[model samples]
Structure formats: C-alpha cells, structure tokens
Target: MTAAATTHQHTNCLRCGRKLTSTKSTATGYGPTCTRKVKAAAKAEIVATYKPHLVAKAEELIEQGGIVALRGRNVFQVVASNGVDTYKAARQGCTCAAGLKGKHVCYHRIAAHILSLAA
Candidate 1:
C-alpha cells in the first residue's frame, strides 16, 4: 500500500495556531516541529489511555462506518459489534453493557473519543 500528497494548503498550523508562511508548513497545517510533535502525541494518547484490544475494537467500529454524530457535543451513536444494537457514547460514558459496569472501558466510548479528536 502507498500514500502520496501532491499539494499542501493552509493559512495556519493546526497545532500551534502559527501563521504558515511557508509552503510546506501550510500544506501540512503544521510547522516542522509541531508536525512531529502532533504525530507523536496522537500515537501516544490512545495507547496510553486504553488497552490495546479495546483500541483495536474502537478502530474497527470506526472502520465499519457505524458512528454517527449527535447534538454536536462529542456525543455519538455507535453500533455494537454484533451489528444489531447501537449505543450512545460520550467522553465519560457509554450505554453499552461494559460501560454500564462503570469499571470497564467500552470500545464505544473510545470510538466517540476518537471521533471527537477528528472533529
């Protein structure tokens, strides 16, 4: 597999809010230093916060395109893995059984968190 970029365009860096005066910076919406920092932070944030299996499940939920935004407050409707049920998920909680347990971290919550970041 491969990925490629042929152009870049942004007026400001997304991370530090700096004016992007150079072409490369504008293209990435990040200055060189911030670009590296953002990548590292993104990779670290998820892994450090959740179990690896849960993270994989959350990513699977996203890849299945079963997430829907609602009410514009970092809330979402996430489909269950069984594909027969849906749950409302927020940053702090979810409606899934595991979420109801209060001691478990549900993938639905992780999916909502991931969606919030992309937003």
Candidate 2:
C-alpha cells in the first residue's frame, strides 16, 4: 500500500499515546492534535543528548539510506566504500531492542542514515 494509505490506517501516534492518522499527517510521529507536545518532548530530549555534529551526520545518513528498495533482501544491492548498509525496517522501526523499548530511532541506524546523507 502507499505510505499515505498505510499512515491513514495507523491507529496511534508512535511517539505518544494519542490517536493518529497517516504518517504524512503525523510526520513527526505524533497525532495531529498533540503534535506540539511530541515535538517539545523530542526537542528537549535532543537538547539533553547528542552533539550537533553527531546529529548532522545522522541526518545525512538518513537522507541517503533511509529509502530502501523493495528488493526484499539486501539493504543495498551494491555498497559503495563510503556508504554504509542497513536493513529495511521489518515493521517501520529501528531493529534495535533499545530503540523499540524507547520507541525512538536507534543510534546505530541513525548514525548510518546521517553518514549516508552526508555522502
């Protein structure tokens, strides 16, 4: 299904217990009505942790590697020396247990995504 369709079917904000519509509607991972609350929380957390350089790198990696193909197997068919490979989210989330527990992006995957974007 399309991302919009999938997001529409989503029941709850992944970041909060509020209800949600589509991922596009709730792009920040919060329900439409409570988006601000989620953003505040996220902002506070980001400020409390991680450096600016690390955050930049993670963003870069995501830009390059976030969108994986439907190949159904390899993270990337061909890996460049400067590129780092990562697994597609089996269920639209980080594979790391910690990430799942905290309901946040995993550091490893974030790092990879940031690096990819930088490249």
Task: Identify the candidate with maximal lDDT.
Answer: 1
For each candidate in the order shown, give its overall lDDT on alpha carbons: 0.68, 0.40
Clashing pairs in 1: 8-27
Candidate 1 wrongly placed segments (more than 4 Å): 1-42
- Quote the lDDT for 64 in model 1: 44
- What candidate 2 gets wrong by more than 4 Å, as runs, is 1-9, 21-29, 53-119
Model 1 TM: 0.63
lDDT at position 2, candidate 2: 40
Best by TM-score: 1
Q: Residue by residue across 1-119, what tens digits does model 1's lDDT show?
A: 11222242567655445687887676555577765653444356777898989888776665444566676737788867666688999879999899999898888888777666654
